[model samples]
Target: MTINPSTLVDLSHKLDSNVQIYPGDPLFSCTPHTTVAKDGYSVHTLTLGSHTGTHIDAPSHFFPDGQTIDQIPLSSLITPLVVVDLTSRELQDRQTITWSDIEGASEHMSPDVALVLRTGWSAFWGTPRYFSHPFLSRDAAAKIFDRGVRVLGVDTLSPDETSYDGVGGEQGFGVHEVILGGGGIIAENLNLGGLMNQNMIALVPLNLEGCDGSPVRAFAWKD
Candidate 1:
């Protein structure tokens, strides 16, 4: 079903230097490669990580044999959606989001739906608190997997704790492994406060071939 044109919510975060990002990731930069006055027309050069700002992570982000960002199916990117708001509660550092939390926000998990978690974390996007935003427990991820969810989104840096490492070890991003590795995708660092009981989401990402991830223009809509 198509959403009514009257009700559309922009679920994406504005990308700029001021926007908070994962530590050690390259900072977003935009420069005038040519001036309008001198060069007769304006030209710009931009540089940033593949996973900057409001972005979607392909399985390749965590798995070596996973699909690239460009390989993501449009049907998976744009589909029915539901947001579970957890902003009212206190979600602390390294805190895990239990399955009970999911059951409290919404009664049913539709198969193949893009499930979004709004932990009210984006409010602290420009500060360190953003890093401490809520995360999904491995059990919660498993629950999501069991329910046949197609994609996941969170208003946090990641659904997994970013304080530790897995670069050369096996203790990797469990949430990502559970979802993306299970034939699902993820949208991170979203600004989903404007959405309200939406039914559909359109996540349009840059068609960057062979890339692990790409920034997205995500929006929520309903009939």
Candidate 2:
């Protein structure tokens, strides 16, 4: 079972109307205007939030002075990644991921790594169950920022908890502010459960100028 470079694994979730979105976010929709039988061409009108499905959150997503998606460096999108499994803890107690969790996972992390938190929450993608789960704590976010992580990703809709009154409510904004303010990007709503081996990830986002964020086609390959 020697994996080679040609082996590609898609780490992104499929975008569709059924996919769950953050509360108050725009719903995904598509309408076909031309079909093979009608105009011998296929055309569709698609609509979705910029952060829909597997997408990158540029600095401007949170910080007004942050860089837009078009300004994201290509080197940051293509890099070595380390996947830390949080499924067991999420399923057992729905506990918030914290700095300690990142510290424990860092024993195997590299200097320039893309940290991915796998909470197995993607299983609830199309259901109401995905929105109410525990989220990453502000402490965890600060620790990640302190560690100089280039990119942060999670299986959940957001790293911050949904309850506006929760502990991370205001602090969570600080987290986004810290990371994006520091030129780091956040990748949300990812589907990385199927990827096993640690390898290189390719994150390609639409080149939309001045846009806060954009949808992305994220993938991984190993050797």
Candidate 3:
């Protein structure tokens, strides 16, 4: 299907040296490899983790033998998008988002569409506050997966709480385990503030063979 460029709303953060980096993850950097003044050409060498910026986590992210980034089918990259707006909930730091907060949006939950949780956390993307954004409860993750929704997206660094000391929260990476273990996908660090109630979005990742994840140029548009 051809998507008109005019209708696209970018859902990805601009990647650069200052791009928000998850704790313990590799920092992003871009250095000039060849300069026009010297090599008669320009080229850049980028250094970043596979999960840097707006990215999709494949099943292999948590499970060793599961499908990898390159193994994901292209047909599954774009789909109907369901945005669950929870900004009004006034969720607090490290707060847990339960099923009750999501039940209202269940009507749109299904296997084909990508379910994105918009917590308005993208506003804090470059600040320390971003790490304290609300997280999904384990039960909530399981329920979402049970509904047959394979693609999960979040505006925060992760669907689960961001661990600072490498020690996990009570729920751990339950959200990742539940979704990816079920052969699902999880898109993180998305800029979803501009998206509408319903639309079509693409979370296409790079074909990085045997990789657990890849940065994606996420975008959405209303049809």
Most TM-score-accurate candidate: 3
Q: Write the per-residue lDDT of candidate 2 for residues 158-192, one digit (tens) a residue.
A: 77665432423544455566678788888888887
Global lDDT scores for all candidate models: 0.81, 0.76, 0.91
TM-score for predicted model 1 compared with the true structure: 0.91
Residue 140 local lDDT, model 1: 87
Q: After superposition, how far is residue 90 of candidate 2 from its true place, in Å?
A: 4.1
1-223: candidate 3 lDDT, tens digit per residue: 6777777899999998779988889999999999999999999999999999999999999999999999999777799889999988888888899999999999889998899999999998888888887999989999999999999999999999998765447888999999999999999999977776438999999989899999999999876
lDDT of 3 at 73: 90
Task: Give the local distance difference test score of model 1.
Answer: 0.81
For model 2, what is the error of residue 205's alpha carbon versus the real structure, in angstroms, after optimal superposition? Answer: 0.7
For each candidate in turn, the TM-score is 0.91, 0.88, 0.96
TM-score ranking, best first? 3, 1, 2
Residue-by-residue lDDT tens digits, candidate 1, 1-223: 6678778989888887687767688889888999989999999899899889999999998887899988888988888887787877767766778898887644556665788998888778787667766688878888887877868999888888766343221234788989888767889988876878778888888999899899999998885
